[model samples]
Target: MPRNNDLNIILGDLKSLFSIAAVLMSAMVVSSLLFWELRSAAGFIAGMLVSLIIAAAIHSITPRSEALELKHAIIIAALAYLLIPAVSAIPYMISTGMSPVDAYFESISGWTSSGFTMLPAPDSIGHSMQLWRSVTQWIGAVGVILLMVTVLIRPGTSAYILYQSEARKERIRPSIRSTVRTIWKVYLALTIISFFILLLAGMPAWDALNVSMTAIGGGFTLYSDSIGHYDSLPIEIVLLPVMIAGAIPFAVLFMMFKLKLHTMIYDIQVRTFAGLIATGCLLLVAQNYFYFYNDLFSATRYSVFQLVSAITSTGLQTTDISGWSPTALLIMSIAMIIGGCAGSTSGGIKVAREIFLVNQIKLWLKKTLLSKKAVIVIRLGQHKVVEKTITEELNEATLISFLWILNILVSIMLLANILGPEVSLSNLIFEVCSAQGNCGLTTGIINPAISPLAKLIFIADMWMGRLEIVPVILLLRTVFRGFGR
Candidate 1:
């Protein structure tokens, strides 16, 4: 891989990316007009032009064909994530009086598909902004880099590097481009189906469109009350499968599309996540029934929806959990921490890493107990992982999960000092995990009134989680020590 060639190609690729983002924002221009929001339309126009200017400035270097190093991939991904939100927040600033920091925070939240919000009320944001946010969530969930590479970059070493830098890997096709195109098709198809289903379930057309777009992208509500706004069982039921689909790895869905159910069921990630969901739902139901809801039906209803929301990092809410017991909240926190499958829109440490950790641990224990001549391997279904891959997976998983938990703990301590005395220890734990896991369930601690430092802390957590921790570290290291090859 020629380092200079990699640099030129990635730069050229990013320039094309920002241009693409501006083109997509055109829909929001029309969206603003449809909603009769002249101010927002102007903001969208301004934002589009500014992004195009920035793209034009990125360079006219003709990309040379070469492989991109992991470091370059990380740098490009981290910078792209940071830069786009800064530009996209313009509409929020112009349409409403939200300060720069507030607007950027909201924009990044949508960009990460982590739906924690500072809005005091839904009416506070224009309907056009709401539509833009939902659209951004859909794009962000699909991944900024994946969208870019699929559109213009050809399949190659650089393409896969850019794609996986978004915290996703696993090819659904022979090449990165094909896989992404298939994923885009699947994602859009699901969004359309979800939109119609929500409409059928009694949501207004506009509301259905927004909710389905966000929900199918593993984002929560544009409304203040989240899923609770409707309180309709049919709506809840329809959304469960959509959220599940959103959180499922596109490869898994691709396998399903190919009718490979037998292989999927035996996959370690599938089994482990299913076990986690079942246990979480049961524990939550018992706690809610015995302590809060008092009725079996009511407990089960909230338990299923909230548990799926937490595990999928979807953040849709049917009821508040503020009054729930510490035990109940802990269960929800655990679900959020585990989150959905790797290569999915949802966040947290991911199901693939969790199973990898468990398998490695089992392999270690078995090795210590077994005879010297014994043969052993960690198997996922009919496949055996090679030792080198196992070592890499373990190293990556342990490192990222450690940094992830560290970020959560630090945020908790900071918030404990900043928030009210009445804010319990459990709620603080829940809040930080929600932010860092990119799981947006809240205990009411997030607000525009919160101190800037607190807001910044949550903002940083979302960025790190969405980038999967390592890239942020790589970027910070580059800033201090200078860029490394």
Candidate 2:
């Protein structure tokens, strides 16, 4: 690619993101109006105008391009993830009176769909601000690039690359525009349906909308107690499927909705994901029953909900996570780290990767134990996975897991040094996993009182987790080299 072209691609991609931000700002403006927040509405309108101007200026300067290479897509996607949240932080600072760093932290957390918050009293956040938070997660759920593809980009190779770069690997339609449109259709339909269900379950309309967005995005809630704030079994039941839907691939959901239920049911990844959740829940129930709560009903209720929440990376806590026994917390932490299926809104290592890694190990052991000349095959579902394919998948999975652990360890050190010895190591590990997995469950460690440096680490974790380590690292390397070809 020509140097100028690369610059143009980056600028153009960023322009699209800012354009989306402008639209989100308009929604926030309306939200502000609904809440009678005059200053907040004015601030959002001003932000929207500035974003539009920047977007237009970039579009005017950048040369027209029909295609973007994978590198271009990665760079653009990475930069957009970083920059979009900075723009999103404006409302937090404006409405919540949080410090600039804290506000940016909140925005990054929301944008990454990682439910960590610096707010001392989440319920005290302005209504518009709370809605904006949910909206950001909703946008981040599918991604900004998907929105751009639907509204801004023409159907082309560039659009597809950008779509894939946003961690969306499947297409439900032939054309990029059609695919994005269909995806938005499914997403919107689910959001509306889930909102109504929550409403029928007795939640206020406003809360319903917020939870619908948050649940679909696999994001934690604005309420400090999360889903437990409702204290209604019906509401929890209403949200369960919505969160699960977020964890399932949109493509699979699209197929299932089209009456191809076998496509999702027989999927190896889906089966493994479902099995993992079920097993985790059972183990947690036993652990809680034996160690924490003597009552089976109480143990099962809390255990099942939190286990599902953690596994799906939804972060809607139904129990006090801090009070969980060490064994139970460890199980939940592992579930969070394993995460949901690939190409879904849920984050973490993803069950697909974990399954691949396990299969690779099995293949290696079989080959070793049988004979040096033994031919080995790894199968995922009914399809035979070739050695080269399995190797690549294993490499990708292991490298990502290593990086995830390294980042968490670094963050843990930072937290311990800043928060002192009183901070529980297990809780810190749990919190770090939550951030890195985009699993919003926390042990009450996240708040405004934390050190500024620690907050920056958490911000980086959320960003890194959402981008899955590769794109962000590549983007950083590209920056370090001054974008040299």
Candidate 3:
């Protein structure tokens, strides 16, 4: 009876998860029919039907619950995130005829908003699949749980717990429901604005729509060559701000809608993000100008856009960087690992946590060397953060950062064993960082034709990176020791 109770508890919220999931999958089915120019809607219709059957089957059995414990929240969060990508993979398998691993890799990439493409030949994929990838990025950026809050969960401890499990905590409103819906509004507005901007820049409607959705979430592009295929300065210029916008915290984005700028100017995350991008841009400009491009205009052109895309974790690129200098690649690697602001669509260690860790390091130094008399109180913004508060928050932030580095090292080791000494160590490291950081920039080592084992490693990195590591940790523990959790 106790075991049954636990099972019931676990299955509780998943009913709503699958129910809403079916609804979201239907949008792709509609999109498929809308784009009847290719394989028509058969693949999409089949994908949606399978997804609906699964949702219905799950909904029929899942026991309802009033609330979720922390463990349950983590489990539910991990399960939904993992499952949606798997179910979404059905479409790719049916339509593109990609191998299961490759198709799942493609689904995971889009759902994690990592933008890595595993499609054997992207050009041959139908328009529906193309749009599905963009939609996955858009929905993934908003989050499955956050979407759940829109129509499923009500106000309570369970609501907030489920929301936090999505790797977000910044409350833009008094209520979780209001906050998520507002974020949805902000995200929608940003995408719409980006779409029109790209359209004005002379991109075709479909291209503009895909870029708007993918760029806002820092996801993959439609073409194999990425942004470079267009070769239009206007398109690149239009996308630069959109990519950076993906990195700005949703709270700041909401403030921007209210036309608030002075307060935003004082935000440490904003300042830090700007500093990193500017520093990276100048460094890349110098390297490119002297080593490759030679022309200042051309160097700056490639430098600024690529650097912003890297820092934002947006995979769009205007050049085939397979030949870029190691120095340039390394510079972008740092940007990718540092990542964007907390609570933004972009992924990485996050700017807010980085600031906390930096301050924590200083606090430790002051106590050890400068003495307690130094009185260096840790602060995030205008507010004075208590020492205990700093310690509490810093603990998780540091743990996640450590695991992030460990994952990078492990992923690199695995890739090294597979690729051997033929590949440049710099390129290998750069590719690993890009995958784990959810920054889709390719240093040429990762591609559709890469070994299947290598693809799985990247898929793991994307999953871990998207969950920011801890939820994945909790998930593994639950899987290995159910009762222990």
Measured by lDDT, the strongest candidate is: 2
Query: Model 3, which residues run further than 4 Å from truth?
Result: 1-3, 37-40, 120-123, 369-375, 483-485
Q: TM-scores of the models, in the given order?
A: 0.94, 0.94, 0.95
Per-model CA lDDT versus the true structure: 0.82, 0.84, 0.82
Ranking by TM-score: 3, 2, 1
Error of 1 at 93 (Å): 0.7
If candidate 3 were superposed on the true structure by all CA atoms, what would the RMSD be?
2.0
Candidate 3, residues 212-234: lDDT per residue as tens digits?
99998656777888888899999
lDDT of 2: 0.84
Of models 1 and 2, which has the larger TM-score? 2
On TM-score, who's better, 1 or 3?
3
| Candidate 2 local lDDT, 332-368, one digit each (tens) | 8898888899978898889888998899889888887
**Number of the candidate with higher lDDT, 2 or 3:** 2
